[model samples]
Target: MKALVFGADGFEDLELFYPYHRLKEEGITTHVASMKKGPITGKHGYEITADIAFKDVNSADYDIIVISGGKGPEKMRLDKDALEIVKNFFKKNKPVASICHGPQVLVSADVIKGRKATCWIGIRDDIIAAGAQYEDSEVVVDGNLVSSRNPGDLHAFGREMIKLLK
Candidate 1:
């Protein structure tokens, strides 16, 4: 299986890396995509290289998409190509795993409406406004979408994602 991970500079360190490595442990081939290629620094000073640019992504090539949290999504949500990639994932009914601020991209893609999901407490209102039945749980799984509240919830987030993929 193949997975696509979306992020940019300022990504939450654990939120991005945990699921990524977990997917690899499950034998899933994963690629990181960002606004551009090369290294992007995480909020905690770690750096991960992007394997592809957002505009170059072909959503059909992957089985799942993972969006990392932190300030990265704030910029990712504004990228037209990034949002389009996200829309395609929903359109195809592929698994989408997001954490913390990650759901902000889903809101911008306008695909979270009526979906039961959760995110960072700071964006609780945004998720609700976007029409999602916001939950405060460690993880919320709605169909192909799996969402989590914060880094503390990464274990539950990764567990639900792997379950969907399996």
Candidate 2:
């Protein structure tokens, strides 16, 4: 299986790396995509090199898409290419895993409506306003989407996402 991870500078370190390595452990081939290629720094000083640019991502090439939280989604939500990639994933009903502010991109893509999901407390209102039935749980799985609150919930988040992958 192939997975596409979306990230950018300012992403939460664990939110990105945890699921990424977990997917690899399960023998999934994962690639990171960002606004540009090369190194992207996390909020806590960790760095990861993106394998492809957002504009170059072909959603059909991957089985799942993972969106990392933190400030990166703030910028990702504004990228047309990124949003389109997300929309295509939803259109295909592929597994989508997001954490913290990651759901912000789903809101921008107008795909979170009526879904049961959760995110960072700061954006609870935003997800609700976008028509999601927001939950405060460690993880919320709605159909093909799996969401989590914060870094503390990464374990549940990764677990649930892998379940969907299987």
For each candidate in the order shown, give its overall lDDT on alpha carbons. Answer: 0.94, 0.95
Q: After superposition, how far is residue 76 of candidate 1 from its true place, in Å?
A: 0.5
Per candidate, the number of residue pairs that clash is 0, 0
Q: Judge candidate 1 at residue 113 and give its lDDT.
A: 95
TM-score of each: 0.98, 0.98
lDDT of 1 by residue, 3-107 (tens): 999989999999999988999999999999999999999999999999999999988899999999999999999999999988988988889999999999999
Segments of candidate 1 deviating more than 4 angstroms? none
Q: What value does the lDDT take at residue 106 in candidate 1? A: 96
Residue-wise lDDT of candidate 2 within 49-166, one digit each (tens)? 9999999888888999999999999999989999999999898899999999999999999999999999999999999999999998999999999999999998899999999988
Judging by lDDT against the true structure, name the best candidate: 2
RMSD to truth, every model: 0.6, 0.6
